[model samples]
Target: MSLAHLVPAAVALVLSAAPAMAQEAPRWSFAIHGGAGVIERESLTAEQDAAYRAALKQALDAGSAVLASGGAALDAVQAAIQVMEDDPLFNAGRGAVFTAAGRNELDAAVMNGTDLTAGAVAGLTTTRHPIAAARAVMERSPHVMLIGQGADSFAASVGLEQVDPSFFFTERRWQGLERALRQQNLPIPERPAGAPGPQAANDLPAPPLNERKFGTVGAVALDAQGRLAAGTSTGGMTAKRWGRVGDVPVIGAGTYASNRDGCAVSATGDGEYYIRASVARDICSRIHAGASGQIAGQAEVDDALSLGGSGGVIVMDLQGQPAFAMTTSGMYRGAVSSSEPARVAIYGDEVLRP
Candidate 1:
């Protein structure tokens, strides 16, 4: 049957035999993140605070509008991240992190559920939109991941703007790098205090974990055509080495979407644990096998932390249910749907305030 004729038949079938599916099909799917954990009240100016809330609303609105207008879920996901990437407050695009060598090496990834296709880039110094480059990598290249100058070169070949590395510099990140360097130099005791438990890597100088938390912004969407899509973007861990790569650009690590499974998840923080846990895709698989969105989202995160990982996640299930979780005190998050306008969450010290 033609699409126009098929629409009414499909609607009738859904209404009569699968009303739940009908309900889900027309609804909007959107979620956002500013950052996770311990964003002190004193740390943000009123203007900055307002910007966070505004960005969340805009991202949610854009995604919803796209889904409402029959746009692809992938388009909605990318559109939401583009908004965040343009905003300087978030650690993406314009305000991305500076490396240990004092350069910007951004990372981003995207996935399409219809066919399980995905793309990513790591250690990119400049490209107008790293997410777009990631999509290009997914669609145009035979490979799934690209790194360093090669990634940048691929992006340039695809017509993405290659800004100077200096464009990524910002005063806040420069100071953050300086602080991380100092923390690296602090001496460790010569030997174990008591027993020979695995001593911390004193000589390697791991970056402090408490610096501005490594929060990534992402979206999981159900488009008008009922397809699923997801994307994630980040500046990577603060004070990271120039060539350091994180889970943000890793498919199973930071982002995953599976239409048949009915859920998509995006993760941020402690890339090593995310990879070990397969955090994002695990959540989707759990939900597909009958776990609640809330339980599936939290369980994987908890599992990662049990193995010493710390980070937050945003998740959405086939039923249009949404959940956000983190081991941290709070994970800067928000959600919106046809049933509701917008709701944002943040931490007020030990308590979570919505």
Candidate 2:
């Protein structure tokens, strides 16, 4: 063959491979939320605000690092959430709020967009990382949801890290529980100095309907393979009773992903409202209907607000576009993408998008 003919053919082959090369390159993005609610500007000291921002930046870095390393979106989401779960500032694993019964009960959910498979755990008391347990449930168990002792046992069977229940205890969470009990005029249950026991609930105040509802932490990501995933973890509602499970562990309500539709979502807020509204799934559905991630996310958040639900959401599309919308005054959020530097914001005033 002539050299000229060979060059033309080679050029065509290189052009054909360009798209695949782009797809294979490390092009990914991640977004995470600590929670969302009425965070009054004057309420936070400068040091406190800085601390929250630092924590959020750390989470963003953790997730972005995974994606940059060509890891799966699911792994990125879990890695991001693990950072928040370990921090005493967010309401996930280590910082989970106490239930009305004076115990920390954690819930978490993880979903893979590529396969539409999901796993969740609720009322978890001893798992070191509830998000890991939720991942295990998705990967190892036939069940989509596991609760209480069963979930703990499954976590154990999988050899997920285990910790004493006290490992979840935080003084701030205990104070929040005490305040909630006081509001209800219920006597705080007394226990031996170091014994873990449920607080007596003659009448637990209806889950302390307030800003505390925004303590859940979640993350969503799109990885180099064009796959998407989402995960959410929460210390249920502060002062919740009767084994109440929130939207954090509910696939459609708190977390949803769809590689086919090209979007993933993670929500934090009033769990009941999120459940009734199917917030996360609804966002993905809107994206499927051709709306941008921001539009779909804001629309669902507005709908939830109109119904008296307060909270926020972080949405990421296959294109690495992120949309953060909150009905409340503030949402603890951060994002990182291949095209942009990491960004973290707490109050609405701090957010700057260009």
Candidate 3:
């Protein structure tokens, strides 16, 4: 029911799969990404790296709980994104980056590989959980995409939580805006009306410039029924202008999944390049063409890099195999499956014992 109870249930699931149980019981696979970019090892303090790892593990645990109960891959994807959205560590809902206008505009998308149903929203301002709104659009509305004020309105009409725009503010993101504006030699816009006053970062210090990376959050999963799902959410690039929309809500580009293709993928990096490369769909298509999930992930990353784009992808196959590929020096990532426990890593050099 509650997020706090999720991990324990997942543990019970693993326990139930012991020798006492039938070997035919299905196993699940899941993986999540915070973002991708030039995250060099020396850039992060031990504390910041640990904080990111913890947030990722918590998200993985939430998704594991859903899949543990044989839930749809779509539900697990949504569940994982919701946790990251609420956390201010990654740039999705609460920790979203600010636009040139000094406001948070969020974007999110979700797809059901089982039926090819998908929903997405961009330029959202007041919806507390953009991932939930994306799901609501897929399950309730006739349209596949919604944007700006109409999107928030649609979310509210569906009984999703609506919060004051100020609720999304965090000192860390504000500091990021300052850095981006200064770099571009542009004057900072006045903080929007109703925005919270600047506050101390004693609790969670704003990541230093090099440590910030890209901050988009995403997940891909394989559920017990052999279906796939993928979801991605982000606040867009810091100091973004003219309502710039990224690949996150554009389907196939940043997030794509398909049972028929035998893979689901979520990607993060430079949105424009990913859009051009069609990173997520390209990975799934390669997998469909009989490449192993690992090879597909690497090939997609290589393709994106060839286009002068940087980022990463989480690829999970129908058989519950996981592969992660990134052109960036580091990517915040983690995974859990029926055969292995949850493990998280931030820097690219950290070897994960999968």
Using lDDT as the measure, the top candidate is 3
Off by over 4 Å in 2: 1-26, 191-211, 352-354
- Cα deviation of 250 in candidate 3 (Å)? 0.7
Tell me the number of clashing residue pairs for each predicted model.
0, 0, 0
Local error of candidate 3 at residue 312 (angstroms): 0.6
Task: Give the per-residue Cα lDDT of candidate 2 at 324.
Answer: 80
RMSD over all Cα atoms, model 2:
12.0
Tens-digit lDDT track of model 2 for 1-354: 111222232223223322243453338888889998777567677767778888999998899899888999999999999999998888899888888778889999999999999999999988999999999999999999999999999999999999888788766677677887899886675532453345632212222225357679999999988999999999978788899998888889999999888789999988998898999999999999999777788778778656776788889888777778776667788888776678777765455321
lDDT values for all models: 0.70, 0.81, 0.82
TM-score of each: 0.82, 0.87, 0.90
Preferred candidate (TM-score higher): 1 or 3: 3
lDDT of 3 by residue, 155-270 (tens): 99999999998888887888888888899898898876776677644437765544233889999998877888999999989999999998999999999989999888888888
* Tens digit of per-residue lDDT, candidate 1, span 1-354: 111222232223212322253353336666666556545565556665666667777877777787767788898888888888776566787667666655667889999988999999988877868889999999999999998889999999989888876555555555566676678873222221221223421111212235444756788876656677889988887667637677888898888988878877777767878888889989988988898766677677777757875777777766666667666644566666665556665542222122
Better of 1 and 3 by lDDT: 3
Candidate rank order under TM-score: 3, 2, 1
